[model samples]
Target: MAIDFVRSLRGHPVRPPASGIARRTSFWQRMHVDPWLLGMLLVLMCSGLAVLYSASGENVHVVTAQAIRFGVAWAVMLVLAQFSPATLMRWALPAYLAGLVMLVAVEILGDVGMGAQRWLVIPGVVRFQPSEMMKIAMPMMVAAWLSRHELPPNWRALAGCALLIALPVGLIARQPDLGTSLLVAAAAVFVILLAGLSWRFIGVMVALAGAALPLLWMNMHNYQRQRVLTFLDPESDPLGAGWNIIQSTTAIGSGGVWGKGWLEGTQSQLEFLPERHTDFIVAVLGEEFGLVGMLAFLLLYLLIVARGLWLAGAAQDTFGRLLGGGIMLTFFIYVFVNIGMVSGILPVVGVPLPLVSYGGTSSVTLMAGFGILMAVNAHRRLLPR
Candidate 1:
């Protein structure tokens, strides 16, 4: 309901504060902390850690590693939250430029471990994905640029935004990471969407996308094409290209309404589901907690999205609205695409479940975004900077 209402007001100017009007800052706001969102994140982290334990087959080593990452990311989130939106906007371009450079560096000096050159290892320092940086930077860059202009940007502005988005998307896709590229693209696009891009134009773009499918298919790598084919008919390959989907769906279906019990799912515990700790972990969730467990996680995700949208709707300036909304929607896509792929409804693209999946850079990027959201909410009364 709030999302729809926000959509209806898309092109309208954000209600300007009454002359000299400002709400009294609460202790939480002054501290740049959103107690509500922080509480939600804490609950999510704990729940996800529990799920990760079961998903990793109760591997304390893996669980401990993920917890450490969560702690590091949590610190990063809180620290970023302390910066005002003006400070964040000031650093936006530099961050985006740095992200692009790192992406290029990834192509040049990045490591190769999982058949794709998407990681940059600082040799005993840290191994991370440069593309992850773009997840936050893309929105910041777009919002920074467009917030200077009027709403429902014209063709020239749209073209400029496209260039900004395409450069990184091209680089990341060249890294052969379809999932990350889609996410990076989504972040930039959400900014445009919220800035009031017209439905007619969106329809035209959708049609163009449809028309280009053949070309897109031709350009896809063999594995990428195979994933689409498997999505269409998993039974054809059942044990080969389709094993993941088949097993994952079975794991979910076998759980029925109440599930087999935590750490007790046959597909996960017996190693039948591929990537049980990462991409397909939602299946582990479904199989263990059943429909009820799956719905609980979904509810958590919905709460996050709703809270994020509320922040976006209440943002004092265009930059805050676009950046906060973009971040939230991108987070939404992370949850949707991961769960959709795991359930066999969408082609697998290797998107991990938001806070639930075990990964360092992903969690950091995600938390950093919420931190930005907090910054926007906390500093709403002050002028942008």
Candidate 2:
């Protein structure tokens, strides 16, 4: 067979000869799996395991719980990516409605934490953050809605989508969960940008946002206002309002070129770093793993975000592209804000580091977004081809 193929090729104008084997490759199989994402996730899990051991000293339960959550989240990511974007679109409305109802339920009868109602706790299981669901659902809902509508949509449709995003964002903000609220807002902005809103319109909205800042400021709680002021100058109140920021900055600086070694971080071990296993987990990774580990972790995130962007750009349909872009960009915000706040470059807004922070709700939600991205990539060549 080989000799015959070579002979056949010799008489042709240099055409490539086909192999005898029949390969079966699905779109799913062809997609770039983003190993960097997978690697980063594993690194995060391992780092979490190490940090939680110290952060939750004398209580091994945190690490065990986080391990289970990580397994569940990975499973969810795999399952989500297996579906196509069209299927996701079909499911988006129903999911959004269910999420909205849950949000309403959280408002009416949810657990209040730190004076904010944001979680739905069921018996014998973990409490779910409805706002997290809204982060995924709102984008899908809008993308699906806009996919079915005309381009440069009329004011009415735009208003409807804006309302869809605004309603949940407002609820989350009122939950006093400003971190998640800002995330939801950022996701919606990406969706709006993908929908092709004009630059003039975007500029006008930015101006309006600037004008509304004072009114929003007035509505903020004392602690919330203090956070902004402290962000402006964390050293001003190092012992009181600024303790967390001070500790976080100190931990990161102490790590130097390389980390203090996993589980050996003085800040994390001595318990000086607040929220060491949650909001400031990145600081733990920094102190223990050092700059090299941090760079590797960031490279993984860069790959994840880049692959997601590639999928969005390559998507055959507008909805898939926008949805893909929105999901990945939201992931970016989660990482950016968490690390920024931890390093004192930004205010502590309480956003968890995606997949790294010890929280089931955030871990699961993040994986689901990845799954959606996978679905988009799996169906890239299926449209009118």
Best by lDDT: 1
* lDDT of model 1, residue 215: 93
lDDT of 1 by residue, 1-385 (tens): 3543465468654554558575576787677877878888889989999989999989999999999999999899889989888899999999999999999999999888778999998878999999999999999999998988878898888888999999999999998998899899999999999999889999999999899999988988899999999999999999799999999999999999999998888999999998999999999999999999999999988998999899878989889899999999999999999999999999999999998899999999999999999889877754443
Candidate 1: where is the Cα deviation over 4 Å? 1-27, 381-385
lDDT of each: 0.91, 0.81
Per-prediction tally of clashes: 1, 1
Task: Give one digit per residue, the lDDT tens place, for model 2 in 280-355.
Answer: 8888878887888788778778877887788788988878988999988888888888889988889889898877
Off by over 4 Å in 2: 1-23, 26-40, 381-385
In model 1, the worst 10-residue window by lDDT is 1-10
Q: Best candidate, TM-score-wise?
A: 1
Judged by whole-model lDDT over C-alpha atoms, candidate 2 comes out at 0.81
Model 1, backbone clash pairs (residues 3+ apart or across chains), number? 1
The window of 10 residues in a row where model 2 has the poorest summed lDDT is: 27-36
